[model samples]
Target: MTDQTIIWLVLGAISGSFINGLTGTGTALFALGFYLVALPPLQAVAIVALMSVLAGLQGLWVVRAAIRSNLPRLARFLLPALIGVPLGVGLLASIDAGTLRLAIATLLIVHGVYFGFRTTLPRFRARTPIIDGVIGFIGGLFGGAASVSGAIPSLWLSLRPWPKAKVRAVLQPFNVVVLAMTVGLLFFQGAYNERAIHALLITIPIGFVSAQAGIFVFRRIGDTTFRRLLIGLSLLMGIGIALQELF
Candidate 1:
């Protein structure tokens, strides 16, 4: 890879690791954003899925406990999500997806804004796994396309009284499974190849190392600070997506 691509991929990897570790949606947005600019649209889609599968797989180690605590709820969410993912993937294959991506990005920004602005969102203290499955399916679908999966669920989990450690742990593995499914579909469409593979190999490690730092840092930072950062990024990412399509 060229130095520039490597740098971008590395940044994307770290973003994935941290977000997946701390929140849940994995790094689809950052990876998609990076790949969108770096590769052909079709290839970018595959590449994003590829990284998600890998990173998600890697993240399982972090969030297995979260899954153990809420298996039934997760099953509900996953069943619907699994159904929705293929539908979403089909949408990706058939549509002129720049618009889809634009839409997804728009939602991500909105999701992030809501996450930031809400001072007292309900705690997921004990949520239905089906809720998560549905969210995950939509998130996987949109996440596969727009890389914003982590935003919604993360926002949800962060608000819940779930221990920060458990939240992080459960999210890591959850993303990995969904990402695996998403990428498999993408690959069937001829999106998988040496380039995407090489990219994943090189960058996932970057994400892993950076995620360790992100985990530590996340533990240290207060919720107030995290919300502020999330809001700012949401605004910026939204505007950037708007400009990418409009301009």
Candidate 2:
């Protein structure tokens, strides 16, 4: 690979993995743009998916207690999401992925801007299994179609009156599992050629180190700060998506 391509790959790895470490989601939102600058779309997506899963595994450990305590709640989102993925994959042939991504970006921007400035953040105190399932399903659909499984759920979970770990327990593993499946699909489709493997070998270690740094920051932040960070990330992610697509 060229030096320029290597630089972008390293940058993407550090940025994406760090975000995943801190927030348990948003690897693609932070990293994909850099990857696209250096590689083709399929290769970029493939690399991001694998990196997301690898980085997310560390996040899973950080939130292990929350995940174990809330298996039923997590399952409520995950099971439906699993079913939704195949349907989403099917829709790809018919749907314009860029249009779908743009629509999601708009929704994220609206949600972020509306809640971002509020002195009091919104919270869903009561149990809402049905809504969680729907969001998970939609997240899965986006994951399958656009490699953006975390967008919907991350937005939804940020509104919950739960601790940061609890919120991440849902978001982290959901993206990891969904994107693991996505990686498998891509593998079968021959997205992981020799070059892609070489890229992964070079960047994965850098991603791991960056993720550790992020987790360090994540552990130090208060819950309120973490929530605010999520809101800001959503807004930034929306802007990133819009620019990446429009440009």
The top-ranked prediction according to TM-score is: 2
Q: What is the C-alpha lDDT of each candidate?
A: 0.61, 0.90
TM-score of each: 0.73, 0.98
Off by over 4 Å in 1: 93-108, 114-134, 140-148, 218-244
lDDT of 1 at 126: 66
Clash pairs for candidate 2: none
- Give the per-residue lDDT digits (tens) of candidate 2, residues 1-247: 8999999999999999999999988899889989989888888999999999999999899989999998999998999899888888999999999999899899999989998989998887998989989998998988898777988888888888788888888888998899999999999999999888989998899999999999999999998889888888888888888888898
Tens digits of per-residue lDDT, candidate 1, 21-99, equal: 4444445555567766666677776666566665555455554666688676556545665676667666766776578
Error of 1 at 89 (Å): 1.9
